[model samples]
Target: MKRFFAKKEITAILFIGILFTLSFFNWRSAYATMKEHTVSYLASAGNKWENLSSFIMDVDNTIHEQVYQKYYYIEGYGYIQELLGKKEINNFEVVKAKDGTLHYTYFTSGPNQVTSLVERMERLKKAATKVGSEVIYVMTPDKYVTGVTEFDKGIPYNYANETADNFLQELEKKEIDTIDFRKLMKEEKEFAPDSFYVSDHHWKVETAFWAFTKFVEVLEDNYGLVFPNKGEYTNLENYNQIVYEDSYIGSMGRKEGKLYSKVEDFTFIYPKFETNFYYYAQNGSRDVKAEGRFEQSLAFTSLLSGKGNIYDATNDKYFTYMNGNPGFVEVNNFNEPDAPKVLFIKDSLMVPVASFFALGCSKVYMIDPRYYSGNIEEVIDEYQFDYIFVSYTPQNLTEEFFPFYKE
Candidate 1:
């Protein structure tokens, strides 16, 4: 009888404990706190769980005075990887060079899916011919090809270079007017040693501007078009160049942390003159007008401002160029309304370049096909562009295809 009573008492205590624990969790999740009222109400169950987990992890993190999630990563997977002497973290492979530079793994594969691309371009070219608009293709090289020459053995398989070369040749055979920027970057690298970042994949501001100059040169030569004098670009005094020291910790640095890799410098280039422009975002039912800037537009500037945290998405120095890519952005330059209207169908690599064109041209219609959901032929019909430039970095080419007919 005594043993039976003891067992019942123990079972009752355990049940009460579980109930208390569950009650506390329910209260914590449903608490009408500021964060809950503002943000948590909109969160999905998965995000709520993540927030709960983050809160629990923050206890130890607070004790150590570290970022909430960094404590767990550093003390958990990082510890295990160090113990095993491994350099790769997830899909990113961290490589160290003799000069203490960091490089990530790169692979080159066969050509991109160009069947849809060719068909779409042909159709667009046909429509463009009705309006007397010409299509131009520009290829931007990968960082592995333009910047880092030294790498760990068997890393960054040299397939991208071959694929880009082959694609350029194919475009030529098809009689498509293409600009192989690899040749331009190779020549620019001779003078601008820091044309590409050691830690990041994007080119430096100097290199981007150089390519823009080359773009004009090609346009003038091939299309018999007049261009601005080279002195406007050749002189650094024409533009304002701001250098933010140690402000960049590229995508590679973010993965491995500052202890493992070196940070890079970022430069912001803006036009010195006061410019007048109008920006329009035409996303299906969302036709909105945005005031333009040499950098980010006025409407979305505050949303993208500030010195973001090391890992924060908006804090990236590259965004100062044109506030990154929006689906469909149109710009009208009041500075020169009579200048030729150009349509740029490109990747994010053309962000800064696109801004430059917007500054010079009377009208510029920028389309990023990857994110765009509108009819391309209709846009060409509406704009009646003088030139259509197709620009993509080598690595991005494989990922983006032209969606010509389908929105």
Candidate 2:
């Protein structure tokens, strides 16, 4: 008994010593990440002190994320904040909502400058309309839903909702068709809390499915791309809902850590009906071409393998949809060959939700302006689709997304 106790004490001491040494290495990596953040900040939107501060918080989050022992470091930091009742982390770069959701926000001096962005949309409309392709601006819900999500005093408000309102209004004036999903979110008040993940900025997969139904409704009512199985398409009962509880930590959750925010439940939803697709996706550097069923070819099930212990921040389960924002993506729905061909030029919010188009449209093509290497006008001219859609989250309403036909 005496020898066993002696060995146990030695093991504990050595383990503690190793952890102490690891802390130095973590900080060293953190400092290097800070330098990268500095360069990235200078290059983009980090023009003001407010932007700089939030961007630095991003650096802090990324540094710890890259460390050898990042999970423990994040756990410790989260615990400290939990004990101190810190509703705001990183000097309000990330704040906990009254409902416990994490948000990336900062104090807004005024509404964002979207006049030029609207002009860019107008130009794209002219080009698309010239080629006989219609343009529709689809607005995804902002994380900070107005009149629903509340934050503690001294927390920052980014006014992204206001900016979205401004942007959509301008598009309407330009006679560009627009879909405001915020209205739908508000109408369904009971599900507002459940609509978005408390730990991340993106909507839940189930919510994305619901949004897709809405997209089909618009296409049917306005553009005449109606589906006979539209009712079956929106029916959640016909889908396989696999709930991976306590497994997700989203982009925002990574920054704040688990203790500061609860682990999210990823409800992976897909159709129970038969489907076939020929999918081709390219992110400029790499390309994937496959032909199979929905789960086989369209979705990346490899991301879902890590049940409850997903730590690599980049291994985000949310990325399971279309394997993340590929620069260019084509889904030929052999199941719906006679259906309309749709196109989306937008952001990551649509990246997952657009998968539902397989059930409705005959063929779907998506371009994430931030990634696609091909010419937008050339693609538009070459393919005269039934409809063309443009969606950018309010927070992402910047010059980078409106990359087509900008004057």
- Give the number of the best model, judged by lDDT: 2
The digit string of per-residue lDDT tens for model 2 on 194-254 reads: 7888888888898888888877777778866777588887788888989988888888777
Instruction: Pull out the clashing pairs in model 2.
Output: none
lDDT of 2: 0.83
lDDT of all predictions: 0.65, 0.83
Clashes (backbone N, CA, C under 3 Å), per candidate, total 2, 0
lDDT, candidate 1, 55-131, per-residue tens? 65544343333333552453466456546655555654655454444555545454455545555566677788888
Best by TM-score: 2
In model 1, which runs have C-alpha deviations exceeding 4 angstroms?
1-87, 92-116, 146-148, 156-158, 190-193, 228-230, 282-306, 405-407
Query: What's the TM-score of every candidate structure?
Result: 0.74, 0.83
